[model samples]
Target: MIRGPVIETPRLILRPPLAEDLDGFCELMADEDAAKFIGGLQPRAAVWRTLCMMSGAWSIRGFSMFSVIEKSTGNWIGRLGPWQPEGWPGTEVGWGLLTLAQGRGYAAEGASAAMDYAVDSLGFTEIIHCIDPKNAPSIKLAERLGSRKLGEAVAPAPIPHTVWDVYGQTADTWRARRLE
Candidate 1:
């Protein structure tokens, strides 16, 4: 039997989301600051849907968003991993941190680990980061992942719908010459 991949960083651990994480997941995604780029705080049902979707991704795609826990405190700070949204081309690398977790560089660190796992361990060819144009921090994070702008597209959003696309990159190219 295959066990889930566990990605470790200097201060974080990215592992599969567990049932115990539902409440923490809701709180993180519901935070105003953390949810800004994601449209906004969603209803509890919406949070449940997200959890189910991530779990489904693991079973269907062999990879999914992971619960990001602070190694030192073991607190659930956020999530980061690969997901394929409807109409999207490839697996997208996404991160959502609790409001308190912002500005700590944890998102970037966790996402970098996920990207490496997607490319090196899972052999994925492409990764995308779709971010609202106004979300400058997310845009910078995408660039740090070696992704390039890919224009925008509208889709059903958590709140008022919007279109956003910050970057896309192929694993082979990024692994060879990653952006600075």
Candidate 2:
């Protein structure tokens, strides 16, 4: 079994999704607000498929989305980690917070922590956050995390939409963040 990386923030724990996380994951994806940029509410089967995909990431690429949990409440909040959509520029750092978890900086915290792990520990030199143009909050989060706008590109067919690439910590940028 391929075990994924675990990251801890001051208020959360990021780990691989367990079988028990399936239901909560479904609920999160079913939320309209959380689903804004993520197409729409997914069927239960789709959520299961996503969980399987996440598991496969560990097996195939040695990394995948980390299930976000509130440290205090110990509740599953959402997910954040490295993902590679075919035809993207590089490994894409992404995050999604449930409706109750929104506006609390959890998304940013999870995303930033994952970015650190990707570059510093995993030796990833290139990372990007692909955000839909209309998702202003996500776009702002990308910028706040020190990502430079890398222009736009049309994603694949099903998602035939243009998204802006938010560049994360490259080797040089990672080095710079360390100095500051």
Q: What's the TM-score of each model vs. the native?
A: 0.88, 0.90
Error of 1 at 146 (Å): 2.3
Candidate 2, pairs of clashing residues: none
Candidate 1 stretches greater than 4 Å from native: 1-3, 156-160, 178-180
Predicted candidate 2 versus true structure: per-residue lDDT over 48-85, tens digit per residue: 98898787777788788899999999999998898875
**lDDT for residue 37 in candidate 2, whole number 0-100:** 77
Per-residue lDDT for 131 in model 1?
A: 86
Clashes of each: 0, 0
Judge candidate 1 at residue 128 and give its lDDT. 86
C-alpha RMSD for every candidate: 2.5, 2.0
Question: Candidate 2, overall lDDT?
Answer: 0.81
Q: lDDT scores for all predictions?
A: 0.81, 0.81
Candidate 1 Cα deviation (angstroms), residue 21: 0.6
